[model samples]
Target chain A: MRWFWFDRFTEFESGSHATSVKNVSLAEEQVHDHFPGAGTMPNSLILEGLAQTSGMLVAEYYDFQERVILAKVPRLRFHLRAVPGDTLIYRAKIDSIEESGARVSVTSHRGEELQAEAEIIFAHLDRHAEQRQLFEPNDFAKLLRTFGVFEVGRKPDGSRIRMPAHLAEAEARYRSQAQA
Target chain B: MPTQDEIFHKVQSALVDALGVDEDEVKPEATLVGDLGAESIDFLDIVFRLEKSFDIKIPRGELFPEDILTNADYVVDGKINDAGLEQLKKRMPFADLTGFEKNPAVQDFATMLTVQDMCNYVASKVDGKA
Candidate 1:
């Protein structure tokens, strides 16, 4: 089963930074299992939300040619616990980007109060070197679209960030298969 | 060759376009990261725009020195040594380092660089001095 940590991206700038939001809800199984009655979101899950926001930013820098994997959390601090009714807003800013890897500063907020802040590093893996596929292309494309990457993303000049031809083709194939 | 005014306008436009900031916000004295709200990722976008606008190739780490922190001779115990600071000032002449001299941490130098510094660097590169 595939897990998406973030609900949708509210802001996306190619090769730069992104902002996403996740709503903590009673419907989430983790909330029910966490305390049975308290209904507090897990701190680890909040970290995942940070990773997803920053990971996509790093991946977009490479034009999605390489697979970006979370390498480490060099620093992390939690100031508050998020409850079921809270809405978590995640903002990730790139610290440095190199050919092999990148670093990002991530912060999660619940209505202006800081919940957690983390510094994350990501390693770029060459797609060809890894024979095994981590994600099916069509599924990944669908995930990107659902995240609002294509809709809200823009270049430095305020122009729309276009989906690469390969991903577009994959999405087309996926749509046709669904229709068939 | 473009005039100084022309170069300034181009550099300012590039920064505005790259960082998604207003034209007035990208002043010569504004620090790119602190004042103009440029993230590390935005540096690449700014460089790309500069290259296309001016028809010049900016090698990695040339516009912004990336290797200074990793070099043992320049850094010690997370702080940039005096010699290293001098070397950095030499490389990035346009940057305002008056405050950085008091206590120089390797990590903090990038944030100290201002938009005017970048514009000057671009001018130098175009003039064949870089």
Candidate 2:
């Protein structure tokens, strides 16, 4: 099963905030057997959508130089159940970010109603050279494209955000290795 | 400058939000690990919330000194030596090391962090500014 919870990002501002949309559908595998006859999207998966939306924002803030991993969810409260046909909009705002990690405030909304809110944390592991391949820069860059991050992403100065050089280099190397 | 009680309350609120513990469970002498059940990751969460609540920049290693714990020179057989304890004391003046001084076990050090110590640490950071 794919871990892609969000469909596309409508708003992405590097480091500060980002908004993404997720369309719940019974056709998807995640909600197939959630309740058998009556399937509803798992709250955990909704949380994942929120995290991914925010995690990408945080990762882009540092130009993807650091390996970002979700460390904790300090607070999360679900106000409504998200079922098939519901379009959930997840918004993630960076409250504080530093070299060590970042703290993000995320919320999920269905139209005008607030579905969920949370405070999530991320930790950086750039110093771990041995585990550098874990992030798989090429695959990550592709994932960003699939999620439409680059299309809507912008820098703090309002300039369009560009893909990092490292990811491009990694993709080139991977293609060469595959050909070889 | 905020009063001691105000600092304690703010610290308490941060702990409650971070650890998902009850407001009453957070007391002066309540051990963060033992009583409130805060794991290593929760410390980062607590620090983040505290920074947000108090609006102060808490540089890494100021609130929790992980470096001393991990240093080979300080730790021996999963225990902190007297010299190590001295360094820890210098790093965390707000913490009362008298109790932990006896055991000085590395694992037990986390459990020694009482809520009062956190308040003291915040007080030291915010008070000195005033």
TM-score of each: 0.58, 0.93
The local lDDT score (0 to 100) that residue A89 gets in candidate 1 is 95
Clashing pairs in 1: none
List candidate 2 stretches off by more than 4 Å. A129-132, A178-180
Per-residue lDDT of candidate 1, residues B9-33 (tens digit): 9999987766668999988888888
- What value does the interface RMSD of model 2 take? 0.8
Worst 10 residues of 2 chain A by lDDT: A126-135
RMSD of each: 11.7, 1.9
Best by TM-score: 2
Q: What is the DockQ for all candidates, taken in turn?
A: 0.03, 0.77
Backbone clashes in model 2, listed as residue pairs? none
